[model samples]
Target: MDALDDLDLRVSGCRACPRLVDWREEVARTKRAAFADQTYWGRPVPGFGPPDARLLIIGLAPAAHGGNRTGRMFTGDRSGDVLYQALYDVGLASQPTSVAADDGLELYGVRVTAPVHCAPPENKPTPGERETCRPWLVQELRLLRPTVRAVVVLGAFGWQATLPALAEAGWRVPRPRPAFGHGVRVGIDRSEGSVGGGGPAGLDLFGCFHVSQRNTFTGKLTPAMLREVLSTAARAAGLGK
Candidate 1:
């Protein structure tokens, strides 16, 4: 837990990507009209949840006015509304809403994080930026590897980013990696010489559509759909019903 705390501090101070650094700070400075009176957490956001979590939820990136302003992954965002509510429905989260960092929300047996920690321009991080920020995810997974048995990746971008991070953390990913799609599931084996031992009995990865406004508003991802995936993931992680 101390190590995870240290990693969070390290992540908060990172300025490896010049573009992301400038953009995140600029948004903080300019301020959105609705959030004019609030100060933004204009730095790389850290993963949130218990260190011994068996279920891991991976997202693409933070929303500019959402996490960038609140300092918590998925907080103060429309996407978070859908995601958290579904998590709550499945017994993974204690609450259905996440408004601010200190909103008294708690996750049970689950951790929420993103591939890219900082909020990017247009809600999209460039390929280079993703690669630059990859090490953080790698280190985070390394710390959580022992307990994390089920990973729920939101969107194809998260799926792609997470696979490499898992591999770097010693999980043996299949060659010609499995493609990402809503409800897709892939079983990853741990390397023989890896921390947890290599075998068929390893982590289970699940794919789900991102809880973005575009997806939810257009019915690309519904509340019931997200709950189903999360419930399945919880069971896979041995969290029980």
Candidate 2:
């Protein structure tokens, strides 16, 4: 397989964080009452999308019963319901729902990933765990740097995590770093200089509230709001033309 495939395979096998490994495996074995008959992936979830994508979406981490069970980022959860529907509405995704890894949902020119690959307890990954998982994201960003033109970071946690990874991947994150805010957009330039003589390739970074039940249920993030952000980022990535 290629570099991305290799990276993904490696990601799926990671057990670097003892806490996350224990939590994820326990959750998998216990099995949610609704899904008792189903088998859980119970491993580090890999990034989902084509290798050379133009748009990247960053999330905090997998939900305990969501990605940890489905084995795909943003799958089998209410959060995924909001995210996928918005993506589909903006013409970035082939389907309006993401239930399973084998669901056949396709993302056009976009990839989805997280700072922490495994689901964390109480949906919160410790700072140490986040750091431990950084290498995988750093490598994934490097692999996508040539083609990725824009990124949409969901939630402040993802926004904070991704800025450092972006800098490590070749982009020059601004001094003071951009603050995370819904509907925020920042332009980042390549620190290493031009790409294909393209005069210092840059990337568009957009921020959106997390599509968690807390946000959606409270109307902190509406369908229209989510779509607007995705559409804007999709256009920046030269998609939907």
Which candidate ranks first by lDDT, i.e. highest? 2
- Candidate 1, residue 197: the lDDT equals 62
Query: What is candidate 2's lDDT per residue for 1-241, written digit by digit as tens?
Result: 9999999999999999999999999999998999999999999999999998999999989998999999999999999999999999999899999999999999999999999999999999988888899989989988887799999999998887898888877788899999999999999987765333333358999999999999999999999999999999999999964
TM-score of each: 0.96, 0.96
Give candidate 2 regions above 4 Å deviation.
193-200
C-alpha RMSD values across all candidates: 1.6, 2.0
CA lDDT of every candidate: 0.91, 0.92
lDDT per residue, candidate 1, 129-216, as tens digits? 9999999999999888778999999999888899998888888999899999999999998777775464323899999999999999
Compute the lDDT of residue 75 as modeled in candidate 2: 99
At residue 127, what lDDT does model 1 achieve? Answer: 85
